[model samples]
Target: MSRRWNPVHPNVTGMLHGGDYNPDQWLDYPHIIDEDFRLMKLASANTFSVNIFGWSAIEPEEGVYRFEWLDSIMDRVAEQGGHIILATPSGARPAWMSEKYPEVLRVEANRVRNLHGVRHNHCFTSPIYRQKTQEMNRKLAERYKEHPALIMWHISNEYGGWCHCDLCQEAFRGWLKNKYDHDLDKLNHAWWTGFWSHRYSSWSQIESPAPHGENQVHGMNLDWQRFVTDQTIDFYQNEIVPLRELTPHIPVTTNFMGNYPHMRPFTGLNYEKFAKHVDVVTWDCYPPWHNDWQSTASLAKDVGFVNDLYRSLKDGQPFLIMECTPSLVNWHEVNKAKRAGMHKLSSIQSIAHGSDSILYFQWRKGRGASEKFHGAVVDHVGHEHTRVFRDVAEVGQVLNQLAPVVGSSMDAKVAIVYDWETDWAIADAQGFGKETKQYAATCQEHYRVFWERGIPVDVITPDKPLDGYKLVIAPMLYMVREGYAAKVESFVHSGGYFVATYATGMVNETDLVNLEGSPGPLKKVLGIWAEEIDTLYPAESRELVMTGGARYEAKDYVELIHLETAEALASFTSDFYKDKPALTVNRLGEGKAFYIASRNETSFQDDLYERLLDELQIGAPFPVQAGKGVSVQVRTDGKTDYVFVMNFTEEQQTVGWPGRSGLANLLTGEHVGEQLELEPYGAVVLSQSRE
Candidate 1:
């Protein structure tokens, strides 16, 4: 059951189709509540998440308890054969609690204690806050452990931010001491504190990085990041102790945040390590679709790459899209509405990767908050006669039609490494020109080539096994941990294709330079020596001239390489390193390893991967040859195949659906022919039974 998409609740089957519902916001308007139930039926949403930020309403006073309102909402959902994802309401503490205990508030990095006005601003290390959260969770579990509507336990909303208070400082020191085996010398060596005489004379001297104090120790910064993540997870584990004890059957999870403003990964905390504590993985996806800087198809590829990353976190298990806006978000610089048919297309795109459900951030928008204008299922108008509401209804209908896609999973033969530790190390590096690092963006660029070709790719961390994948690509892997080089060597020696870009294997886990060479531990496997890395200005670019006479543009970074056992496939055609090897390949055994010594244009990657696709005998998931802006993805339920074909462009696209007869179009309940024509922002789910 864990291999596929496990059901959220036994009573409610099919794709989960509801979102964060805050009935507490409209408690006084009984008519609004009545209309919400009516519209819920119209949208075919069977699940509703309640009490996400309802702490103030649940516990208005320090010791006073109020659950009659929540009880009514739970009973009503059950009466209508729906499910409730009950939240513990720890995302925001009650005003009374904060007023009673000042320690509950977080301390900023500048050592200023916060005045607790916003959500996710509580001290994760505060004993009083932990005690209060456990008490609330226990009370909720005691009341609704056996309730028919109670399905899942949403522990907290978007767990992020860190505290630098005295409590947290003590905890961090303890963590470091434990990691270093209670030896000050080991801590000093690991943190490389001798460089600036910042070595700790006492444990009390070590504190979280600060602007006015200390931030130059890369090792300390890295450890601080790890400590914050551990502390956050430790706190989450504390919140769920009661839920695990009382309602062991209910799955517990907290929604994870995706990339922020400019498609950068959320660097606040490491979700990879935190994902192990939860039963299922879920994330909030809000891509800036149809933006002026990028094409719709390009944006779709980015979303696809991220969805695959989340799906791969659970080993390809069907995860849930906990929160996504139906139209436009109020937080963007320009809140542009979603174009016609895009809502359904984007929703299906999630399912195509490995999502079992497409849920929104809010069921209904609030009236007087910062997010009042944020897109929701029901806007401030309080009716179902809106454009965004109709799009939600349409997505719900499509989810209903493609029920078989639920609990399905994707099997990919390609694996791309996107290690968070490597990213953290790269981000903390003082060199490499801050604007040009773009670690996540580089991985996405490589991933897009495979995505456009409909080649299923698993975005994995550096530690994951590479047993099944034919090709393993690790782009911008600046930090090579212990034994990882041996792992790559063995993988390539055993006839597996390996690809690594520039800036890989430069340093150890402690942020110290690997004296073995520029590529350090990986030099032997990569069959090349990176003598120097040259960072180019934004306006500067070099030409990568292949041996086959194909010229492509290379930019951002260029590595001077001296071959060991590899032969040059491409060379630079400009500057002092003109005609030097820009790309090389080494035949280890039955397979080969390719090293790209510089960053190149997307056109170069597209051409290179297309050739690799044929050489490896890997083809698209579907048999159809799709046109430009058309994306084809596939998922399997172990007995059947579900192919999702979507057109992400503003113009119509066609796909040559060869020899795919008698396949049922699950959305329309019709048989497909040899050719399928898709309109702008259109999508179709084709299901075929296995032999």
Candidate 2:
């Protein structure tokens, strides 16, 4: 009988580990191959991602295929009781192909065509590239579908980066035709091309937006961003369909860069749109780099937020950590190494947020290449005794011991609403003195308050189902889609607490402002009108005195509101709008909607969060106040709870774990009391044993 994994895929072994094993780099000595099998066996690893960047190696000259070497690697892995994640080497076209069809190369905004060197610099619009990629995928599938080692199909590595060649521009026109139904007038209006005489009389009048530079029309910029994202998704769709037809049982997925805005060419990556094409969601986890000048606590928090974001993309289904550094990375200005015990901590962190597999970028370090210095499973010493190697082996052993974690899921009562369209619209806009740089910062501030207070929140798109969540927050929500206001109204009137900060419901889906009034669709539910928006100097601060005797220092953007049905909870104490409502609440049915018109101090936010939870009659799921630096996350196998307690700080600290007084850790089989001490970067999985 064939085995099945959660999210509807096959898994013939215990929780998958290992990644990107490019044995082709070590092909000089057959003994190296034998040694790899020995090391993988010693490490208890069962999965290997192969052919990640093997385009030239697999198809060197013309259509002459050379997968026999790959076949040998696949057989060797299978004989050693391992499975393969077969990757299509389409991320980079072979040098010969790129040399032949320069149209396949990427073109920058200045029209400088990129040379045939780096990966992900391929033109997304090249039909030749797409056709060759699809053919390669089809061949890879047919060749390995029956092989016992083949378990999954990886389409390409990190599928993004924009191109500006004429073919791509022509392809953009075709995509626009489909999007706008070939109506130039509608396109013109939607793009708001009247400004700067950008209106198109014919379909051929348009070109890539970056040439006009950053100061182009805002609506055009937003639409062009959406168009570029669509091009990437279209390429993925074409590649995946062929693979599915060839290997009916195999699941297909491509790794993502986990929504780090500005990493890709544009600021419009709709992760939700890409999630629909794959059987399982896979994302690379390389948190923002920190030098000696900065700290990594924020990095850990970012990982937590993104892990939940990707998990929410699959509707709480477990995803995979497709690429993470074994120790340090090479891209940043200062590449920082993972501290001792962080390997286990990071892996568990991913698993706690619903990742079934934890994999690395490559299995072994290279002798000479662009990424030779990057972290790898086998270091320069080429031995199993390295510190990083021990960590990798220990992680595999721990995963094998915790096999029951497979198929486990997590649920949250709080939801934070975010959208790529909203991000793009705000980023594209310039007239508002209220800046776009602080949009994500505003959301993260609210999320951090909850994180510090031990309140787990699911970062969700606005269109997600709101049936179960008690509190729904849309922070810096500037563009509210059609029917979304009605959805919020219904959710509030039906007893769900709704919280929106400044800039909520200001525009429609088309990046067009709601001329009716500010705070457009949510005005009725929020029961207030944004009379005016103002921004203060960075160092300047204002005061907000709440009804309950707490005073908060407010800063940045402020919306002076004229209330209708809303009752003032907090009033500003400075400026011409002194004593005006800064925070207002409106009661609907048994629920209430609170609108915060300005960013406030951290202490104020903490106090505000507690009051909201109290008013909503909701409490933390577990005793998350287990002291500082401790994170308590819980996941269930539907019936039993497996709680992960981790210490992110450097000093040893004792904290309380949720549930009965004492429980046995599955790893050590030792009974952990309610109060247990975790050393710096230590983590433990406490298994719940029910009566």
Candidate 3:
């Protein structure tokens, strides 16, 4: 089922083309401000996010409010017929507030209080911080609630970090008490504190996981992470009270951060639960494009996978790229500028998945700061003559031309479960090698096949309803939350194709291992039981010989499976467990469930899913044979389908286009032929009217 994309602002139509604008930085220089508006018009940018990280600018001292600077910027935007996404400046507190209210400072896990310096360092449980933020938000809402330029509420700039202060420790205790029904016995059972005689007689003994204190207890660590997420959400809710009261019509959203240092999703907070609090979802996407570690196409699939996950957060609603670098960010180990035409290609690719906007991090580069070298539309020279500016303007033109694609969504028939809780459990597990876990990356490998074949897949959580999906995939699902196994059983029983991988069903939500064999609750439905799992080393490898005489390579991990009602489709051809079942399939009521007992190469997944795709009759949106680096995705209004064909490679490629009659390129207003040639990093948008 395809869900219609909800617009973030009713009055602001078309794709949002602007980004984070810091006009407050230039309040002293009016000439620079004058040039920004001229450049905005030239770039065809319409929306700007303002007041993020502006605590000091808005309030220089305690209660010394300065609304004139903000007022002028809002008025200037309104005068230019642009929208301003006003943000709450609580991400960082002013130095004055930090000095006066030392309680706002966060204490580290080892009990080292942080000095007043960086951002996202405020303690979430501080009542003084919450009160001050609420008061500031109230004033802003009262001033801008009626302003025509105001569009959406940018909650806070990337809400993350944790506070192990005394206040937060007490809050965690209260949270645990409420969760365990105020019973120490239940809490002890859940935490399994009987081991090592760590049973807590009182709540005061329990504290957030600390390196020097209690890091070995998995349950405590898991609960501590959950508590931090809840605490952060609580603080965010406090900041939005005034906005919800004054500007109910405007939607509210906070920019979510993607995974750092690797290709995994952000693990600091569980976005699945936090997504429910926002009216619309938005996130910062800074994939390391053109990196040496991976191919352009391979990295593109990763970006697509994360974008798909973000889109599925709101059930297929179009999300916004709140803060992406237009050129290159200064933070990476090597900050490399985007190649020519890569910006437009990447921007359109975001829209192809489900993004409605292509907003950047900073509109103009900062003069002197940590992010001064970060990419921006206007360089430090402050002109629109640069190559980056031209690329951005080109994207703006394309967005304006593709206005009808706004509020359109993907109709995906497949869903891949990417559970955050499962990821945390797998990472925190004691046995397996941390390098081989790759929970998020493993899911990405499964998704790569679908992405390559142009089959839309919703990267969903385990709890999301599986009613509309024809096929569901769960990779490395080590932790099965309550009732998820039952949900999978019901899905398979109702004629849905279910696929799961190794290291699945090992534990419960609290990192408690299920007793009666592996895949404990799932055994009845899957018709297979795992006796033991062999964790292979980095250089180890094995062969999986299928029953059909096809052989494939397996590595990293393998599970010994005892078939109950299922038949082995493939078996291992090496090691002490030679000829053991490596892959098995079971036929339940109306559907079949397949389990891969070992980690195989991408070739194996490609072969397996190709058969499944044919068996399930799931194909591309249109009958097109896209080249290796070319990708095709579809969005629809039910009466019309917006097809985005993108070339992610550096060479010219020709796609065997789906030459449907009356299908015309939406960007060029020209009809596409049977064979379409795409230049390096090129893209084409076609619209086909179903009516």
TM-score of each: 0.98, 0.95, 0.98
TM-score order, best first, reads 3, 1, 2
In terms of TM-score, which candidate is stronger, 2 or 3? 3
lDDT computed for candidate 2: 0.79
- For residues 9-119, what per-residue lDDT tens digits would candidate 1 score against the true structure? 677579989999999999999899999999999999988889999998988998798899999999999999988989989999877887889999999999999996889
- lDDT tens digits by residue: candidate 2, 1-691: 0112363345454678888888777777778778888889877788888998888888899889998889999998888778888998888778899888888899998889988888988988888988889888888888887998888888888877688899988988887888889999998888777878888999987777776566577666666777777888888888887778988888888887755421221134677777788788888886543445434555566677778778787677778888888788777666778878988888888887778887898788888878989998888787899999999999998888677878778757788887778878777667565453466556776776666666667878877888788899899899988888898998999999999987877777777778877689888999998877777778888999989878988888777888989999999998978989999999988789999988788897788878878877666555644656577777775456677877877778787745567676867878877777788888888787434
When 1 and 2 are scored with TM-score, the better candidate is 1
Looking at model 1, report the run of 10 residues with the lowest lDDT sum.
Answer: 1-10
Predicted model with the maximum TM-score: 3
Model 2 error, position 426 (Å): 1.9
Give the TM-score (vs. native) of candidate 2.
0.95
* Candidate 3 structure quality by residue, lDDT tens digits, 182-278: 9999889888998789899999998888886555788988898899889989999999999999889989999998896455678889999999999
Order the numbered candidates by lDDT, best leading. 3, 1, 2
